[model samples]
Target: MGSNPTLSVFLNHMFQENSYEKIIQTAILTAYPRIFTDIPLSKEIFDELERIRKTESHGEITAELKVSKLAPELEARYKLVDQLLHKNNATQILEIAAGLSPRGVEWTKNPAIEYVEVELSEMARDKNKIFKALIETPPNLQLKEGNALNLKDLQKSITHFKKDRPIAVVNEGLLRYLNFDEKAIVAENVRALLKIFGGVWITPDITLQKLLQVQNKTTMPGKNQEIIQRTGRNIEKNSFKNEEEAEKFFNNLGFTVERHSLLEVIDKLTSSKKLNISQKEVKKMLEPAVVFVMKLEDSRA
Candidate 1:
């Protein structure tokens, strides 16, 4: 338990009173609309997001300012998830720890896709109200109260979806908050889900301690520090020792894993004008990020 003065100082400044809920709030309410304007739901949710920001983080950084600072990195991560989702033909998506993300709201626009978003109790209740308020609520979209670590609740939550169709379980910004044991439990729960439906688990939640340590060595990597300190947790100790260990960890949990470089999609995003960040800047932000696509070995062809 040694202290790294660099990370400590940066964390204190950037994430003074942040938490997992606050981070999710920033992404869905702030970053989504501000950066990913091409998506229709992103534009539609602006007023609602403003209301949430006023109530959720009042007197803190305004949603616009916070998202502008986080725009490039956050948009890149979302693109990674969107890319991976398109890789599978699964018509059904079950997003865990869904927060207020507009993925379900947006994707349900296509009648073929059944998007189920699950969050813990209070968050689920609030989002349900908003989803209901929309003029055209997609019949295929659902918001439920479920915990990632609770197998029974997860099992019950997905009952509305067709039993025979495959399901892609998507999670982001959830695992880093969990300890090894908690992660393992979530893995088990996801494994069970795949066992039944036969699809993959898509996540960008895995982190490498080395990459973060490298970032901390630099003078102005406050974004990395904000991610770590927001949870009020020591992420270095929770993160994988290396990428190899991460693959092995999931492999032992019965997954056949594919690792995707989060930075690889930056060029596509920037070229499309969805991301205003430069290549040099995007490279720096992607230092500690990666996306993992986990399929049950048996599900693989």
Candidate 2:
């Protein structure tokens, strides 16, 4: 073989295959959540991601922050995480497409935080092995494998731990791979879970098509970076179009959508920063990508 190609170029090749999406997602499962290590679990989650992406298939590393995906923006995921977690009084988080990153498990300083991570069957195996080496107490944390749409699979996994508690659900980089039916099915399950258990923290992002049009893309590593470069994996994206549509989509599904963006959340989380954008500025940029914190409409003091 000739000299090893740069990792970025290799990733571009691997994603050209049929299972490129899975491979890319698995890579993201490994990366994509470390921007918030200010929270303790964020560091643990970051470490877990580092371990999982070490696979030869995910991609090669030419540069330090070589992975790529959505937002294509700065690492402000913590602000997103913090707002959702705090608003719901979230104690349990069921993270779907949770390859190996442990943000849900690692970011919580709230002693009550418990995370149930769900990944596909193959990634689950690697995730479990990595998870075992990373934690001693398994009470606040659990990782299981299954299709996101299968409640039976979720049920089996849920049986292993506390069955009765309000659980917040996390979905990151999941909507792109799911069709409308799949999305609806998962939403139904989330509704079922929250209705039974107590909470749902969902971020259904704009489609891949719409995301690409944005100017301030996060050059951050998403699972698909390698695949996109190699296999010509063009992600299909849909525009959120506008806040009205975005808000209506989730609202119909039973969540109260507080439409904000990464910057808004960052402003809220970081009190003192000259680099911070003003409220009007963040609100303006939010036209393309905004954050929504949803909770049960009926809940009241």
Leading candidate by lDDT: 1
Model 1 lDDT on a 0 to 1 scale: 0.69
Candidate 1 structure, TM-score to reference: 0.79
Which regions in candidate 1 have their CA more than 4 angstroms from the true location? 1-39, 43-46, 52-67, 133-135, 210-230, 270-276
lDDT of 1 by residue, 76-101 (tens): 67778988999877689999997766
Model 2 alpha-carbon drift over 4 Å, by segment: 1-26, 29-74, 107-111, 160-164, 204-211, 215-234, 267-287, 296-301
Looking at candidate 2, what is the lDDT of residue 156?
A: 67
Error of 2 at 140 (Å): 2.1
Candidate 2 has its poorest 10 consecutive residues by lDDT at 66-75
lDDT of 2 at 71: 22
Give the TM-scores of the predictions, in the order they appear. Answer: 0.79, 0.67
